[model samples]
Target: MAEEQMNFQAEVSRLLDIVAHSLYSEKEIFLRELISNAADACDRLRHAALTQGGLLGDDSSFRIRLKADPSARTLTIADNGIGMNREELIDNLGTIARSGTAAFVQQLENKAEGANLIGQFGVGFYSAFMVAEKVEVATRRAGEDRGWLWSSDGRGAFTVAEDADAPARGTRIVLHLRQGEEEYLDAQRIRQIVHTYSDHIAVPVVLESKKEDEPDETLNAASALWTRPKSEITDEQYKEFYHHVGHAFDDPWLRLHFKAEGVMEYTGLLFVPSQKPFDLFHPDRKPGVRLYVKRVFITDDCAELLPPYLRFLRGIVDTEDLPLNVSRELLQNNPRLAKIRQALVKKVLGELKQKAEAAPEEYANFWETFGPVLKEGLYEDGQQRDTLLALARFRSTTREGWVSLADYVKDMKPGQEAIYTITGDDPKALAKSPQLEGFAAKGIEVLLLSDPVDDFWLSMVPAYDGKPFKSVTRGGADLDSIGGGDKKDTAEAEQQDEAAPGIDALIAFVKLTLKDQVKDVRVSKRLTSSPVCLVADEGDLDMHLERMLKAQHQLDRSSQRILEVNPGHAMVKALAAQVGKDGAGGVVEDAAWLLLDQARIIEGEPLPDAVAFSQRLSKLVEKGLLAG
Candidate 1:
């Protein structure tokens, strides 16, 4: 067949340009990426061979072969696995056919530094360009006769042509080294790189002898890292294995390795990443833990193996009890797998509990990254709700860092009966909420929840310990009963109430004027600084929940909220006096609406009628200025 040349995809061209110009700090990663791809191809063939006969052909032993030719300035990585045909070559190599390609490109364009784009985007094949001036891939897919050659110069174009002399049953990638990249061609350096990055790979990585007199060397252990004893593994080995299995750049914050020797036996080697995965919140993202039955590859994604809340975990679960040919559907209904999942959850949660107790500061950092994800269990996994709640942490009105439910309970005021919380889109803004002012003044801490998941889980988890969770933005705070208040402040508030004799009449007048827009208008015990604030009625939805539902289009309209006026504020006192004299008409009517709109704006709610609000504000401002 004739050679066909094609321009790279726009994203791929951008990627190649960055990569060829040394996008990565560590050039040795080129070998790691190639080896990982080679190992994946081998694993695929091994799995396919179970159903299809003769896929492996004569090369039943799957291995990755590496040859370095210093004389020719080339290093070759070859694998006898599931190599690609012409179309597969083009589709896989010429495009970034993955979700979040646009996001990846945007981040790159924004100069995001030290990113593992190759691993994160499934474009590891292109990393070869980091160290090579040119690359050539020659391969024949397993169980197919035709072969193809793919050539690229890392200059935005690649060519694919028929290769009569391609490998019989796999791929062989040759990297023509650029000047100063001679380290990759050294046997010792090649061995060191493989030991550092690809040692955990299950496939054997063979390094060809530099001289005719020596035998070819297998640089890796050629066995699954999880199968080895935990005592035999070092921390560096664990980290390298995590990078290989997780396809992640960050180190593992926590590593769990254990063997379940009970009725349904399995071995699990899981790592909790220090950094969140790029697709952790993607709707289609599933757990990346590979499942192997008796060391035979089954599938990389088995959602049934772990609860979705623990989806951030990355590694492998190899079971002796499950069938090697088990399909995904079968895995879902498998009782033994369910048992394994339950046990794994318990084990992980227990380890986390220990870690939280031993090293709280470190665990707090982990919680910052994965706490929102772990909170999903409170809503979805009923059996583990208590454990998840204990593991939870939050920012609070009184504290600078994360506080646990246990710590909050311990620090509760003498007469406090509930776990107070306030939900919003931002913790910093929530801290400044007028509704929290009275609580803050009384030294009562309220939990500040910022994650969207906080809303869902708060509904499922009604309380922590024996204290019911009460939103500060709800009508009934009963702040009078909570002890710990400045006696002088109480006396001053009482004095203000006496002096502002029109406050009750003003509340009644405002209530009648804005009856259609508000559930009720009343004086607030929760307001100390702001003139007014909004809160949900006792039986209505929480203000934050209502706003969130409306924003998501899940709810057509928000529940009416109570408008609470601060009796001590100068503006409120003056408005009350005006209402007392004018009796609920003209200027008082506009003031009533303005106060409601001001409260809404502070609460992050949009005005119902912006034009009317503007007109009323201008009229009021003009009247006040002329009087002054």
Candidate 2:
């Protein structure tokens, strides 16, 4: 093949510029990225050789070699693995093959935080430009006689040519160091970087010195960390392994290292990050785990390895029973994979349960960061719904910190029949809801749920520990049956009750005036301080859920709400006396509409007509001033 010159993809050019100028803060990350890519290539070749028989040829040993020459100002990384051919080299190195290029670039422009978008996009090769002025790649694909050389200067164009002197079957990347980047040519520095980052890689990473007197030395441990016995690994080794695998800077919050044997054999080393990833909620965020079969890398973005609810976990799962040639299509819906997933989920949940019990404060911190995400399991995983509900932590009107459902049940009042809860967008706002007034007066506690997922999970999980979960904002809440009020308060309530005929007339007149605006008008036992509040029907959707759906354009029409008036309030008593003196007239009708509008505003719902509300209020104030 003749040498060919081609222009880099437009996205590739933008990405290279970002990498060279702003992608990474530390220059040593270039070596980590290159070594990680080399390790992946070696793993791929091992997996391919399992079925291809002679693909390994005479050189069965798989390894990576690093050579640095201070005089030449160059550092070369070589690997005996599944190398790319001519077309593969161009497509992989010259273009942004994965999706979301535009979004990734936009993130770079918006944030000054140095992000590892390379791993997410599979463009770690371009990271070489961070420290190198130019890069040259020589590779020969396995089972092919021809080889190719790809050379680029971190500019808009690159050249490819046939290389007859390329190795038998692998890739060698030579980076020409920039002026100030000559420190990378130091052999000791290269060894230290490998041990710090790639020590857990299964392949041997050998460093060849520039001095003739010193022999070649293997810098890394050359064994899979997960495959080793748990007792043999030190805490620092485990932490370093997690840093390398997760591409993260902080230490892990928790680590799970275990092996399942007998029938299905697999080893898992999973880590929960101390802080959330920047893309934790990104719609296109890839999976954090990598799958392997007998220590050979298979796929890193396989969703089948773990349920979507646990996507925050990062680690590797290597199984001995899976076929070396298994493809992702074959792994999906496979019974073996399903069984492994089930077992892994159980183990993860059990570990979390233990942690929550042993360290309450630490678990509370974890919940603060990931509770909303974990609550998703209640709706998605029915089989584990009970476990998840029991594990959930909630904020309540009575507690100083988070309380579990079990603790709430245990702390139930003497005759409390159900667990009361209220949902909204903010906990502090929900705490001031008029619907909670009566409960507060009676010294009853209600859970204040503010997460978006809280509305969903509460609907799916109706009850816990034989006590039903009841929403305080719904009409079905039975405060009387729950022994909420005492005899003395009941007597005080009777003294304040409106005259029977006057109250009856007041209810009838208000209902008639607001009939078109509300589903019904009735006296309320749930409001102690407020004059009126809104409540949903027993089977109607939650108020918060309805508002959310309407805001999202998923619901076109608003559901009618029932308005409940507190006869004990001074405003309601005055309204009743006024209605008894005069029949339902325009003034009385205006008052009815104003009461309903106020309730709607308190419930976080927009008024049906804001202009009418303002006009009516202004007229009432004018009439009051003239009379005074």
Candidate 3:
């Protein structure tokens, strides 16, 4: 009977400070936020029938309407779906954050995973405060007939009044655009925003556009894409939807058209883009999948709709069942939502495995652009690691190209029990490593890894299929023991270290002198001709990655790496003999420094002591001339 005025919750004021100033990067996000909320209500109505039909109020068709008042400079978003009551209006708007919203957002920021927070909120409704000087939320619950209007200036408090004639079952939000924001009242502006961000929505999103005969005509597909059969939607239409919904120009590399019918009725049309979206790194990039309840547009707020790793994917996910709110808090906990997201992930990955097997080249390009992100799965999601792994591709030791674990498994030696790999900063460099010389001689292939994310992925994807992944640099290289045969050069190195005048004792002497920097100085077990090599201590961080992190974070100091030496090479042999002659001979010390420096150079590393290295180089050249 009477309008009631309410005070803003203590947190509401604090939240207003953040929503207006901090929450979003652009003021336009308010439209996205509000529009998303309206869509969620429609989606919830579409699905509520299966669980408890009373919540939807017999409305089968749900749509969103956009209206503008040129003279008043006002825009309104109205939906014919489930609406909220007085308490809901206050909880949604009067509080800075409901419990779940605050907790999830805080955890993300704490974990420094806020880079993908866009659309992961219920607070998105508050974004309207960013552009509207005056805002009104008029809603009536779907099953109930009475309506209430809550209006706010977004300063602190709000006013709620009874609405005698609130249209049908949904909520209508009106925004009095700020002076400079009056442009949003333009028909063109409205169409642009809806088509750019809401085209693939499962519900109709109508914008007022000028027509020849009528003053205004509804413009936009405003239709659910996934609800339609695959026969009706063309590939070009699908691409357009991807570009519009994802703000991505790259055409999708793969499209997964699926309908999960038996247990849960849902239709999903998802696309794997050929490239990462421009804002893939932005913390506020909106989720590309639109959520629908029984084909009615709901919310696109849950990045959880698709796993965070698949945040780059774009498409529509229309389900007959899911909660109707745009709040990430509810979506995260909702059993139906969690199930759909999990199923979607498996389906996408399974489709990927199919692509990797059926059309290897296409999936290869997809992997190249998205591999590091997918590798992240190996560490974070062990349950799906093997499945995601079946789609992985890598460079082979014997080939100039990439190979899948499946292919490698097929190529393995009869007795080989593990999938062997070697990681370094440079793939080409690892390929040339003396450690691989013995494997090559024995016809064993090692996967070449150059990505910084390689080790991180390897750390997570510890095993592939039934075979475990073993880093070749770690241990049990045992190349000499393998195949019961050795390369001619390996044989010579073992012989050279043994028969070449007093070499075993010399090696021990060199180890004693360089033990501080050297791990273990053994006669060449892997190196055939290379004089010296560096191997990471078994299970320690590999060389290239250590270097990468050091340079990436710009750490002031770095951990020293272990140096491995090749015993058979003449340089090593000569150094050993010289060390045997004089424990602290000036020439021998110089030779020791040279041996370490030479090993560092071959690994593409700068010398730990560069100036001293230059001096040693000069001495070594002089010594050669003096000998001649």
Q: Which pairs clash in model 3?
A: 39-298, 40-298, 204-222, 205-222
RMSD of each: 2.1, 4.3, 9.6
Candidate 3's TM-score reads 0.65
| Model 1 lDDT at residue 135 | 95
Mark the regions of model 3 whose C-alpha exceeds 4 Å error after superposition.
1-221, 281-287, 294-301, 414-417, 484-499, 545-562, 577-584, 604-606, 625-628
Looking at candidate 3, the ten consecutive residues that score lowest on lDDT are 110-119
Q: Rate the local accuracy (lDDT) of all candidates.
A: 0.87, 0.83, 0.70
Q: Indicate which candidate wins on TM-score.
A: 1
How big is the positional error of residue 30 in model 3, measured in Å on the Cα after superposition? 21
lDDT of 1: 0.87
Better of 2 and 3 by TM-score: 2
lDDT of 1 by residue, 1-628 (tens): 9999999999889888777777777889889988988998898889888878989766699899999998999999999989999999999999887778877876655435535545765677888998899999999998898999999998989999999999998899999999999998989999899999888889999998878999999999989999998888889989988888888778899999999896888999999999888778888769878888899888888889888899999999999998776776888878999899899999999999999999999999999999999988998999999998999999998989999999999999989999999999999999998998788777899999999888888888878788999888886669778888677766655564564768888899899989888888888888777889999987788888888898889999768788989999878887877875643367888989999999999998889899999998888788782143
Ranking by TM-score: 1, 2, 3
- After superposition, the stretches of candidate 2 with alpha carbons farther than 4 Å from their true spots are 1-27, 48-61, 80-130, 133-178, 211-215, 282-287, 483-503, 551-557, 580-584, 625-628
CA lDDT, candidate 3, residue 596: 74
Quote the lDDT for 545 in model 1: 85
lDDT of 3 by residue, 283-354 (tens): 564566877666545666666687666777787888777644445476767788778888998998988888
Clashing pairs in 1: none
